[model samples]
Target chain A: MLKDKKNYKLIVVEDNIGDFILFEEYLNEKIENPTLFHFERFKDLNDFQDKITPDFDIIFLDLSLPDKNGLDLIIEVQKISKQIPIIVLTGYSDESFATTSLALGISDYLLKDDLNSTTLYKSIIYNIERNKNLVKIRESEQLYSDLFQLSPLPICVYDIETLLFIDVNEAAVNLYGHSHSEFLNLKVDDIFHDEEIDKTEEIASKIMTHKKKNGEIIFVDSRSNTITFNGKKAKIILSNDITKSLNHIREIELQNQKLKEIAWKQSHIVRVPLSQILGLTQLILDDKETTQETKELIIILNNSAKELDKIIQEIITKSKEISLNE
Target chain B: MKHLFIIDDDAVSVLILKKMLSNADFLETPMVFYNGNEALNFFSKNYTSVDTYCVFLDINMPVMNGWEFLDNIQTTIHPNNFMVYLLTSSTSEYEKSKSNDYHCIKKFISKPISKEILNEIKEVFNSI
Candidate 1:
């Protein structure tokens, strides 16, 4: 009663009519209105491959076909089936050959004599579910692989014990000036500066010096973590080049130091004589014995000195502002 | 008795201060020293708890600067007996703020010392 409610789309590739009919009866017994496409020869299946779509749920592949048989038939059918689960149907009870077919990516291998509706139905359901999970796992693996390969920052995987470079992304290849194969041959210590190799364990998230293939030295902010890569204990390092930024900061500091020196000179040295001039002029104007004309001229001189002091003060303030900005 | 002292390297600055003090009609004629070491020597010999001493001190001198003078005399001088006026041509906020560290330093005066500043100093001495 439960089988009558379901409809299954199936493809059968068998040269034997009796075997094909037997498969059809077994499928119909389990799935009441099963949609079957029976191809008597492998050539006929190959010819109709262009019309094959993912709508076909399960493929019942005959291990022995008139035009193609054994491993060749399985491989060709798999090419057409794509994501669809294939159950190898055979008359022989060869256990070793069954294991080999499964290794070749067949979803399941079943003997034709032992094949009943219940057995066929169970095999179809199990293989389809397993193939769906396999597809999902493959997709997840591809996504992770893409992330590693396409990242902009230079990344490398090295074996923890030997420190040999196991894998490197395209960015790492470009940055280190080493080809992919060349990097594999070199150890992590080879890229590090001779002095820095001794301190590699303490290199996480710290700026360290590295050497390129051409012997050019670079500063990099390195971060790393342990990972089991290809069954080997390894460490993955992501190196961010910080040479330009560090140099930029140093340049700014030097400029600030120069500015501070200039400010000090302005405040201490330049203002001394100016203050004397102001003092001298004030004393002259205050002198009771000095003539009126001389007194007027001294007032003008004092005002000019005051103006000059104001300009010097402005210069000191501006220099401080510039240094602060840096 | 009240005593006035001018501790500065520049002769012209000392002359200007002395003239300004005279014009302000200060009674005591100030003693002059070229540097902090000279002033420190004078204080070591002449220091008395009874006498009120007002010092016009300049910061950037050749030997023993104003800071050195303050550090040398900080323990010896009583705050009530001595009043230090920091007179400097250096327009530095850092030096002004740094002057606050000395308890003997009463006021920071930017040079050249004006008639108003002299009158203010005279008032502090007059009050004592």
Candidate 2:
């Protein structure tokens, strides 16, 4: 009842006037006040293509036109229809051809012998709904494709069985110093250093040593997951270069080792002589036979020795705090 | 009677300890050994449990070190008869902590032994 109240805009392209009139009657039985455009030949539709807008919901194309028909007519109509759904009207003899036409982007195919108000109306309603869903799926797929192409971190997809590269993004091409075509020819193990190539099977979220085309060895934090790519079982790897930071950590560790060695020397080797100086000076200052002038100089000497001892103590304490991390 | 012993390689440090002991009026004349080996030899020959012994032990020496001396003496000597004071010039917390492992070691003293330190030693000796 609700479908009978809706106005449907339809385009009918047929060489025979009788078939066009039958399609119009079937459409009118379901849709009230339907706007129908009739084109006698494929050229007539081509000529009126500029006036065709997206608001025209469906196009009923006859497979056997006078000048153009079959796949050529379907393609030309689709080029003009754009988002509009097209249903092919064919004979019983062209039934197999009409079914194959669906693979070439035809929305639905109906035999002219099976022509009835109910079947014709059902094809129009079903295809228009299916076309809208197809458009949504295509847009979302394009969005994901754009995300893969424009990513900053180096990403690559490789076939899991052959271990060969299937696809690589722009960042991966630049990082590996390989052209896009060169990367496709290489296996995933080709980028790894010889010692690390054997461990490639377990490369999920691990730091591995890799070699570039220029023979520069680098460290990469690689994270990978299994994904089906282009109908093949594949793995997608995201690589983060961490060579500079790891080298910086090693340099700091070496400096801390030197500092620890200095601390040990200050506590043991340097403190021994200073202890003797302090002891001998204290003995002089305590002697009853020593002159006042000599005792005064000995007191001054003792103070200087104590000050040097304090400085050495502070050095040892500060160096002991030098840990590997900080 | 109480006996005093000084075991150190440094001559100046030993002289200062001996002077400080006399200045503190510690009655017994303290015996001296150049290293832990000399001290161990003396103890093996003349050790008597009848008299209480006080030892001033230095850590670093040529033939035998302070830790080796303590390890060797533990089996031969009774801890009650001997009170050992460890003296070292090195300011290492590791050595100080390690000294706690020896039961006969009475005190850990940092070097350039002062008059007040000797007096503290005399007080602990007399009380014991």
Candidate 3:
């Protein structure tokens, strides 16, 4: 299928002329970038640095460009501009290198073997669509900030380096008794409760942490992710207020302990009669005994069996009493 | 001479427990009580005569149960520090916790109390 006819201004940053021609042949596009730069060596990349433009919609990168190998070149490219969607082009042998490249903010990777006219077009379409979604997600977060002014579960995302709140959902404002601007003024640890964190999990890994807000400690469980928030590197965190549920579970656990204590008695003393029945049944079934011995065994089994029936009745009665009180 | 008491309503159980203690050399003479009430009655009558160090008790019984026996133990002439080993087929959680109530009770052995359980009893005896 033809691309959803994107007049997308694409910049091709590959060093190999053969691969570049193949990329064009693969895209089957008659048109080419007016500012397409070619470089087989690292010096060529430095020479053409300022020649890059802001209007470029897609960046096709080659990891093994002679100036640098692996992420060195990708970092150099990002040092230039990160807003444009990146599509990595790598030969099959260096295919594994694409994942690291992608993690470093490359948008997509195209296997040289899988590079067909259709695939190349599809990659471009998908990468552009993904970029569109990211922009929309950010826009939605911004446009709906006020509507979240009093959300019950307050959420704040901040930059790792700046320790500055990038944004707080509305629930955070009401929970902290702070306005959005007030939340923005506080660091995560300022209102975090030590007891709450200890009661919960120690949320202190750079991956997680506890902070105090309004004389109360809040737990922050965060995932280290790469995102361009406010045109700078930042973190996105989803936080939950667990204070109420924490105490609620503690009471339930105590009740469960009491039930388990009784359940313990049921397991030990209660099953004694049943197990005796089973073991005695085994003894009677063993044919290596005399008829007289078997006769005595049957008598013992009958008495234990009758005793167990009575014990079950007593247990049922006591259990009903416990249940009724419960 | 160390004399231990065995309380079990079943004759076979009493026999098995008797053989186990005898083989393990638990004491010079160990008395048998067919039921908890019999043992309690024996204890009531004995009062201060015999030096009884241990009592092997069964939980389920007619007339009076093991728990009732333990309850009566608090009121009896049976002195403290006499550990009770619960020889029972009970794997009940309640029975295990109840074992804690009788400070005199050392351990609960699940049945059929085999030679392995006999070994465990020996180990407890050796430790004490």
Candidate 4:
């Protein structure tokens, strides 16, 4: 089959010699562009598992294999790969048998008596297509689950508007310290500061206003606008815990407040001494209004006053260092 | 002359609504109530008149909710004379759908009624 074509590989796990020949003739006579294999017992699965890479598109299963009878071996075969579609071919065609087969992830079931070459061919191709879709769906679920688990940002999806938490990721559970069930029970008020939550309707408005998960308002200067937590809208929220970033901002703000205080002192308190000096110099010049010696002394006093003014100006100008000190 | 009623718990919100509606010449004068029960009581006493066309209702007011007021008025008074518009800050989608469950409520308007929404009110009244 590999030498003639590059297509799906099929595994037939039927113990009956007659049924094995029938599967072969169906592929050879009824199926076109198909590759086939037949087995008498469950050992062939292990044998094939060792001899070749397990990449069969379909596993045509018989419930009564020589050694492995009933639904157990079909499940064992199913564990191989959900992508490898297992269609059970059974003489025992009952609802219970079909139910068990389906519960065990057998893609479909076929009755051996009704197994014409056409039915076999159609079943093989149909199972192959079903297997492809199953694989695709599984891949997508895994990919999304991977993102939900590993993404750095905390994310959760809830029903829209009901705000009932539907699905939550590991990051969301970690950030909010909530289990999936616990998150489902919470409302918009549970996470926020109670006084702040007096205005929860406002937060919902903000969420609706900035539909992007990233838009934020300063909660405390140290707060990030973008933490997604439990909202009752049954909305999905993806929040990144920026509490650390917010803390850094608060530290800087406290520092800035300190600097602004220093700047105020320099502007007013520090300049008070210069004003006293200017007053003293004016009074001295006023006391001896017309002497040349007094005039020289006044010039000296003026220069000292200017120096004091410059010092005050420099303190005011440089207090902006509070910004850099952060 | 058209008479409107203001049902709000917050004094400031009711004051603003009254002052704004008066300035807009939207009514002769809107009667004000600080809670849903007071407004329902006023309606019980005054339901015989047909001039009250609008009730600017706050949903979270004490004594009774906006939904309860609608329910009470159904048995206690005829709603043919007045239409209630829910101007609330609640963004709950459940609340939006549940409002449809009440037969007397014409529409649920969200909070902080901007100029566009108040203008829509005028359009609804002018057609009458």
Candidate 5:
């Protein structure tokens, strides 16, 4: 199939001029308009550093360069070829050195004896594509790690079967009063108050009290989800500290209890005196009273006492309803 | 006619009730006790038939309250023979609902009892 006309930039960091020509010959067979930049030594590449833009797709590094060689050369080349794929070309067929060179971030280790158009062409295409995928994977991993570590709320991953914490973010270490290593040694139950687990559903998120490593119990609204962590079934817990809010609710409840007690006393204590006033007035009205003026005064006194009683009753009833609702 | 009893600590309440019953011309004189303990002592000695006695019970006395009196009375005699009316200062809904649990308690009346209510109580006893 005919491919799209694309400009390909390549760098050959080989000191041997004959090997550089052989690489160009192989690359020319597969690629069209391959811009080749040849640097004979590590010092030569250092001088060309300012020109080392990201436009270069791949770097063909000769391990035995004039200034640098072996693993040292591969590391130095990596500094300039950030996202570019680097293929190590060597006259030696030493498998151990090639393995070591690959470990130092060289994309592929190619032998000079196996230099053919098809072999070089395949290595270039495969390593470039593979490097692209590796870069993408690293970026996504960095994004996830940044989100986890920099979150304001505490977050942790714990092995579901053992309940042991697999990982804890910075906020979790601060909130739970445990170092990362200390948290890894603890189970989920160890970080929670006994009553907290009793009130919480095993599979659902809830608000409950948690015990820190230093023995301080705090309220936290937490969510837990089943997840896979390093190939093990684990749970991710996200928690927001709610101790202050819970304390506020407790304080309000205490105030409400005192209010209820006062309302209770109003129902009983206040009515005692009021009942006496009513009884005394009734006795006066029944008395073969001596005068009409005395009767009228008693009638007014009785009505006032009844009105006061009604007001106290209304207050007590309303408060009782409030307490009952709670 | 059934014998009437008033168990109360307050002097004015007992005095007012006496005058009201008299104004209504109730036949039997009500036997009065200052506290629930005194009423319980009287019932322990004199309790013979529930149908023959009617009590106007009060709460909040020094020796024993109305609830204790009710509890004590139930243990000593048959629950059906006596008719109890709670006549007290408490207008609390809690106490009112609690009074329903006692089958022997025929009515709950918050004081002060009028002559009309006294006549009505007399008519109820007459009908029974």
Candidate 6:
């Protein structure tokens, strides 16, 4: 009979000729003009492992091969065709072992006694589609995990109920001075100052103090949100260190106070001597016993003192304005 | 009608001011105190009259400063009993502006107290 053409490349690993013939007959009923590759020994499939370009759509593996059988054979075949869906056909009727094989990454497990065309066809189609979805889910999960782990800011995930740390990024480890294993042993309260830990649950973001592993307290700007982590209700915290900025502001305020004190002294101290000069010069000038030339010299001296006083006044006035602004 | 007073530590400043007051024909002998503490002490002991006194109060003094004297006097006597004129060689705009905070401080006078200033003071008291 001329087989109808519905091209699908398939691989079958079987030591038994009888089972091989039966599987081919069953596949022929469903698939038309299928390219089927058969390997009698497990070692024979290993020879063709590097030869295949893309891969076969499905692999029917007989667990009881000449060299390798059961879980070991499934593992070996799975290593070569990591992305391809694998179905295990075995003569053993042990349902427990069949279940064990499925857990070990085999897509489907069928006994040779119960194998039929319809059952064989259905297992191949369903498992291939299922494997595709699983691969997509795994890739997406990797993408999200990479985003969290590789973040630049210090971040951590902690269980909401237990308040225990579930995971922390590299940045968090370096910032808090705690190793990954050490952090796993710590609760959320361990990093926060005693008074501030209670507020973490109440507020989403705030500036607060935190303690590092070395028992140093630092100011931090913390932002947090609730999220599901490893199937547990947890909170993710992103914190930025602000200790340096706070210290900078404190330094500026201290400098401003010092400057104000200097200005106040300038306005007061300089005037003491200037007052003496003015008072003395005026007394000398108003004296009737003084000559005209001596009086002119005293007047010039008085003008110089007054000019110096004006400059000091301008400084005091500017400093006062600065103090008022503060 | 106003009484005249001079509160200054400098004897030369006191002499010059007293002469200016005599020239201005101020009738009273013009009560004098060397420093802010002495001035505050005099006011504490004496009965302050209803009539205002024109006081040429010097700023920088040994016992107590002008600002301290003003603070003490605010609680001790009525604000209207004194017409305070702050006298200083300091051309500081800061202290000048600060004088406005005391309502009793009528004027900020930078020394040397000339005849024109004495006449201005006379006119101000006469007008009041």
Per-model TM values vs. the true structure: 0.65, 0.59, 0.32, 0.53, 0.75, 0.71
The superposed Cα distance between candidate 4 and the true structure at residue A180, in angstroms, equals: 4.4
Query: For candidate 2, what is the DockQ-based docking class?
Result: medium
Q: How many backbone clashes does candidate 3 have?
A: 35
Indicate which candidate wins on TM-score. 5
Total clashes, candidate 6? 0
Candidate 5 vs candidate 6: the lDDT winner is 5
Cα misplacement distance, residue A247 of candidate 2 (Å): 1.7
Task: State which candidate, 2 or 5, has the greater lDDT.
Answer: 2
**What is candidate 2's local distance difference test score?**
0.86
What is candidate 6's local distance difference test score?
0.82
Which ranges in model 1 have alpha carbons more than 4 Å from their true place? A1-4, A40-55, A66-69, A93-95, A143-154, A174-179, A195-204, A213-216, A269-273, A276-280, A283-301, A314-326, B1-89, B93-128
Model 1 agreement with the true structure over B43-84: per-residue lDDT tens digits: 999899999999999999988999999999887889888999
Write one digit per residue (lDDT tens) for candidate 2, span B62-126.
79999999898888788897999998888888889999999889888888888888889899888
Scored against the true structure, residue B20 in model 2 reaches a CA lDDT of: 78
Query: Rank by lDDT, descending?
Result: 1, 2, 5, 6, 3, 4
When summed lDDT is taken over every stretch of 10 residues in candidate 1 chain B, the lowest stretch is B115-124
Q: Estimate the overall C-alpha local distance difference test score of candidate 4.
A: 0.65
The digit string of per-residue lDDT tens for model 4 on A45-152 reads 766665434466677878887778776786677666444677887775554786677876678988877778778767877877777787789899899789878887
Candidate 5 lDDT over B1-128, as tens digits, reads 47899999988788878877877777889999999999999999988863477899998889899999999889876656588889988888888999999988888888877667777878987777
Per residue, candidate 5 scores C-alpha lDDT tens digits across A101-205 of 777777897899888988887887788789889989999999999899889889988887888889999999999999999988988888878754531234466
lDDT of 3 at B53: 62
Q: Model 6, A191-297: lDDT tens per residue?
A: 99865465336456789889999999999989888888889988899988989999999999999999988887777666766766776687678678889999999
Say which docking band candidate 6 falls in: acceptable
Report RMSD (Å) for each prediction in the order shown: 6.9, 7.3, 20.6, 25.7, 5.0, 5.3
Ranking by DockQ: 1, 5, 2, 6, 3, 4
Q: Model 6: runs farther than 4 Å from truth?
A: A1-60, A65-69, A72-84, A92-95, A110-125, A196-201, A223-236, A262-266, A270-326, B1-64, B75-83, B88-98, B101-104, B110-115, B118-128
User: What DockQ does each candidate score versus the true complex, computed on alpha carbons?
Assistant: 0.59, 0.50, 0.22, 0.01, 0.59, 0.33
